[model samples]
Target: MKTPSDSQNNWDSLREKIIGLGDHSLRKTYYPELQQKLDDLQQSEERFRATFNQAAVGIALAGLDGRWLQINRKLCDTVGYTEEELKNLTFQDITHPDDLKVSLEWFHRVLAGEIRNYSIEKRYIHKNGSTVWINLTVSLVSESSGNHKYLIAVIEDITERKRTEEALRDAYNELDKRVAERTAELVKTITALQEEVADRITAEQALQAEMRERMRTMEELRRKDQMLMQQSRQAAMGEMIGNIAHQWRQPLNTIGLYIQGLLVPGECGEFSKEHLEAGVNKAMQVIFHMSQTIDDFRNFFRPDKEMTLFRVDEVVAKTVSLVEGSYRCQQIKVEVKTKGEPLINGYPNEYSQVLLNILINARDAFLEKKIADARVELRVFTEKGKAVVTITDNAGGIPAGILDRIFDPYFTTKGPDKGTGVGLYMSKTIIEKNMNGRLTARNTGNGAEFRIEV
Candidate 1:
């Protein structure tokens, strides 16, 4: 390269020769203007050289075949290579192997007149055998005749920016993994809780079904007990009818005998006023006694409508009176021994029925065993704040096998035709269930004893 001052000396020698060939007047006229134009061109070339060498980013020029013709100072520092060293190698030799194919395609497109310039991010191999990330922009330059001359490439280092973006991506992936694990745990816990709730609901349903079945069974038993009570009442009514017949038999015969004797007196011609008056008086007395007997049986059979206060001893005595006639015919004696006038609150008629049942059962035992002197003794007293009545018989006591079951419904030792088993069962029900009392039976030395307490 020639210095500008040397070029000026050469231009002076060439001007002397041209002045010798041309007119002396023409050289005198154009010499000053020519010198001014040469000075201006030199200044322009110096400005371009200063800007290219001092630029902050890397700048380079390469031939169409990728041979580096020139490299700036910044480009030498960026790739850790001197300008002379880069000149010996093509741009393809410094480019990373992974990025070479795409870079060559862009260069070809420019050569084919498809684009004016292209910019891409790519990796370059540094002189120290390390990778350098960079943003590269390349433009095509042509000669004055419009033929391709060389390429001008500008590059910026972007290694730090790329490293920061990679770090952010890794952090986002870790956070997403933690969130997924927590969500799975919550779903599993919720499923377990739902299953436990279902089990509890099933248990409650089973318990409710069992309770309903028990209530239905209790209702059925209640209806059966009521039916048994009605049967016992009917059986007792039949026994009362028999007693009434026994009581009226002797009175009816006496009245018949009196009326017949009066007829005989008329037939013998001795029908006097005094004799007729005496017969009428005797017949009226018998008829009055018979009427009283009917009233006792009628009252005994009437059901009690409500609770009332009554003495246990008085109820026992009245009950014995109702059955006395029948017992007399059967030759069974009843003795009542009362210690106190113990009062209790209950259905009075039902109490009498209970006593009548025990008395009748005693009579049956006596007849069944054929005891010579059958006797039933009842005692009424107050024991431990309760009214109590006990009836004992001397008919060889109830058998050991059947004593415990005597009060059970439909349990009887008598033949079916002679006995309906509901009598004692209903009697126990009246004392215990209806009156809130207790009825118990046990074998005694002479016979069986039944005790009632309220």
Candidate 2:
């Protein structure tokens, strides 16, 4: 063994001889220069051996057959062996079983010239029977002729590094599990929310459909009510015209007889002023009454534009006169009594029509029942600042069964050809709904009494 001092002195001598050749190499003599170059090569080999013995990393030289030919102090320390003990052992003797196959594969590839060097992490068994992890790098050392030779392997202990990698792997696996669990919970919550939204949409659609159906039903009812009202008014007009014709019959006949009587006095030359005046006066009186009847009908039949102040008694009196001639023809007596002229703000024509409807119903009752000496009494008075009118007939009251429903639309006691059934119904509607008054009927000893309060 050469001491480190002998190697150091040889390297110093080579440096001094190379400096003597100095600036340019071609200026040096040949044989002496060759001798200096050989000396420098020898010194480099000595320095390499010194570094290999003292290196901290393990270094070893092995045969291509996996036998250890040379090993440094660090390699012996890493394997828990002295140089003499490791010298007899092949690398395979201490390599762990699991790492042996891969380690051999790399060695063979290096020998075959397929690879120049290789690095791997492998396990080796120390002499003390403990395991050691190491990073091993094998470099191929071939002959100048490219023939396969020994291999040089450099190794570093890495037990702590391998343990750290195992702990990190466990932590990554746990994190992955927690992420999967959270994702599953989110998916479940989203599904529930979607179902709730779908149910609410269905309910809203059902509600909208129901509302549309109700609107259609209401429109149909309104149209029916309108048609019925127009028909009722037409029926009342026909009845009023018939009464007018009845009133005109006697007056027209009397006027013709008076004209004949005047012709006799004129043609006989018996032109007396008294006879001419009396005959002319009687004819004029009949004409005046007929004109007055037409005027009254005109006022009562005209539609009112808006509410106005009018006397209830006067309205009642005019309404009675309209049917006065008809009542006498049927042998029915009508008496009208009033206390004071009660003024009210309302539709007077419509109010008269309501009274007409009631009186006509009474007259019809008398005719249908063939009641003799039938009479209808009308009373107009004021009660508590409100106008009141009542019409009582002696033609017998309505039957108990349908009396309560008289004011209902399309309810009637008369036959279909005789009445439209909406007469009394429309009367009640005009008084109560249109005029903001009350019209009610109740049975009395004499007949049915209809009361109007405004």
Candidate 3:
């Protein structure tokens, strides 16, 4: 058997090996299993830490007092706070005002162990004064001794989903409102359509009646136009007769005076061959002028059967010469400036008559106004590839507000006896209706301008 000393020696050697013998220790000999277990626990802890930091959803370890112990990267991103910043804040501090009561209630339930965990969709106030919606799931963490230690919170960002839901709700409301409005519009449209169907036949009958009335009115207008045209021609004939008389008055008197002078030379013996020749030549010139005047008057009264191309300047000059004596007698300065020898396909004699009537109206205006420095301007030129003529006169511009009515039929400033008033009415109709042309009038500062575009 073993002695006490041997037993003691065995016990000491075992303790020495287990603890330390010569340079060996108990830790090196016997604590390898515990150390390996501790190393394994530390590695697990490190892995958990890395996983928490790299997690997609927010993860937080908070104290029972609601203070944050640790916050992961996702939690920091969720609250727009840095990890260091979140460590100094509490969950209750960041909770939205409206959600604080519910969030606290759920948290207290978890703390009391009444629930294993609590999940609530709650709002948090971000640092920038914006709200963040999150689905927060919280669980209580306990020590091995069953003492509550910390809370583990997982926050899932649901702000975008909440916004989408809100947008869908708003869209539904707008769609409902639009549907109501469209329904009302459809109802009104159907009512209007029913009324239109009910009155369709009556409307057609009324339309036919209106057409007949229009035809009757058109016939009456045509008759009135014909009557006015006849009256206008008669007035023009009367004026032409007056002009002829004015033209012949001085010449006739001159011829008679010359005949009497022939008697003077025979009686006084002062008349020589030269004087007789001069007298005869002068009389022939006067007679020729008178004959030409009659021819001109006849041609002006004549009508054109078809259109012909004619020089605008020739017609204007001829028209001016027709009334030259009258304008000269009235001392009205008449000017004709033709820059481009404009040509037109039109009735020459009728156009000449139109010019004559306008001149006569101007003369009448000057007579009525008694203007000392009366002027009549006629300008013909090519504008926009069309022949344009403007007739302007210094008669104080048609008396202001009445200028628009001047072209109306039977509208005249002259007294009824002095004007037939159909002259300008006919002038406009011939220029616009007979020929493809336009006539417009406007008041200038010192006169009226009549523009004719052909």
Supply the TM-score for candidate 3: 0.53
The number of the candidate with the highest TM-score is: 1
Residue 44 lDDT in candidate 1: 68
Model 2 agreement with the true structure over 307-376: per-residue lDDT tens digits = 9999988888889998988898999999999998899899999899999999999999999999988999
Candidate 1: minimum summed lDDT over ten consecutive residues — where?
1-10
TM-score order of candidates, top first: 1, 2, 3
**Pairs of colliding residues, candidate 3:** 19-25, 19-26
Candidate no. 2 TM-score: 0.54
lDDT of 1 at 359: 91
Tally clashing residue pairs in candidate 2.
0
- Report how far residue 186 has shifted in candidate 3, in Å: 29
lDDT of 1 by residue, 396-454 (tens): 98888888898889999999876889999999888888999999998889888899999
Candidate 2, run of 10 with poorest lDDT: 22-31
Q: Candidate 3: global Cα-lDDT?
A: 0.85
Candidate with the larger lDDT of 2 and 3:
2
Q: Which portions of model 3 show Cα errors greater than 4 Å?
A: 1-213, 270-277
- Against the reference, the lDDT scores of all candidates come to 0.87, 0.86, 0.85
What's the true lDDT of residue 391 in model 2?
95
lDDT of 2: 0.86
